[model samples]
Target: MKTNPVIETLLSHRSIRKFKDQPLTEEQIQLLVESAQAASTSSFTQSYSIIGVDDPEIKKQLRIISANNQFYVEHNGFFFVFVADQYRNQLIGRDHHEDTSVLDTTQRLIVALGDASFAAQNMAVAAESIGLGICYIGSILNDINKTSELLQLPDHVYPLFGMAVGYPDQDPEKKPRLPHDVVYHRNHYNPQPSRDALDAYDQAVRRYYETRTGGTREETWTGQIARGLGNPYRKALKPFLEKQHLGLR
Candidate 1:
């Protein structure tokens, strides 16, 4: 099968959980930041900033707050927190002697989030291209107040997510993905695929799981989603989002 470089890079992507305790070179860090800045911004606002946290003590505290994942603090050499920020623009407005307080709208917040996410994904792809491992830490949202206090985020700025980067310690098998038709649509949106289509996908996922995990555990896509949604972690996301001054009326 013939493939382009971009397709090949994207197809082989996986989240690297384990990493070697090696520091990233200054050149590499600069390249990552440059690549992140190249991503398209919403209305050219570029409402995002990345915090590079290298302090061991701070990393340790973040590790505890981020689900007690010691790998984040002990293993990874560099940590980055991506923030959705309108604060910079607020300052721009202040310099121009204009009001910047009206940026508290839901639309503005979403735009900032979109900008941050685009930049993060760009940096992740760039890191992967250089044989570096990366894992996104969504669990940073688990304690919004503490995270905000630790980062000293101003109003109109929120930590969207975090990324831990280093050389891989181990390479796990690539997890299976849903069928293309399930996610891809034609001109317009379809309700969903037929039950038979979903069943075929479930069987494929089940087989993939059996082979990948050496028959130790089995799971279908629906079952996995159901299990995840059934947990208490699912309930707190919306309220937590609200507490962060996001997604409000």
Candidate 2:
């Protein structure tokens, strides 16, 4: 199929870890936010917020909380915290003397999360189109409680993920995704995908990692899944979510 610029940009996506020592202009920041705001929202609720962090002290605090990758945070770029927020709606309900109980349910939480994710992807794509590389920081969930406290997050608001965007210092190949057949089903659900296809993907993943890391981390997708899922991760997030009045239907 013939592709357009947008499709080409999407296809060339990569998670950039290293970044050059440069700051994004205010215009770029505004454009990124505008792009994010243009994403589809659930019921037009716009149940999301973005916090751009530039202070070194705050970045240090976030770096400590994120635990794994701190490269971009330590450098100069735009670090945005995408927040899944329903707090505004809660307040709106209070002003209207309306019941805000529905906002505390799991369904509403899902909506808010989807809103935040869509906004983040829009910002990411826009940033990439402007020659900025980006990486998502999910390790912040390692200490979501502390992160909330540090950010002074109110009830009905949760930090979904952080993104670091800057000029690319390193060029990396686009990571492989699952095959179209495996991911895209026409109508009915296909629970049993071809084992051969999965095995081939595993090999492809292994080769990608090996070549990327100079053979130091030659691991298959299955191996990564096993390791990543082997231990309990963010198990405390359930209580955290309840404390934030989310995921509690």
| Candidate 2 local lDDT, residue 135 | 92
**Clash count list over all predictions:** 0, 0
Q: Count backbone clashes in candidate 2.
A: 0
**lDDT score for residue 243 of model 2:** 92
Best by lDDT: 2
Off by over 4 Å in 1: 207-216, 232-249
Compared with the true structure, what per-residue lDDT tens digits does model 2 show for residues 1-249? 999999988999999989998999999999999999999999999999999988888788888887645767667577999999999999999999999999988899999999999999999999999899999998778899988887889999999999999999999987899878888887899999878888999999999998999999988887888898878779878999999999798
Q: Which 10 residues in a row give candidate 2 its minimum summed lDDT? A: 67-76
In model 2, the Cα lDDT at residue 240 comes to 90
> What lDDT does each candidate get?
0.82, 0.90
Error of 1 at 124 (Å): 0.8
TM-score of every candidate relative to the true structure? 0.89, 0.97
Cα-based RMSD of the predictions, in order? 2.3, 1.1
lDDT for model 1: 0.82
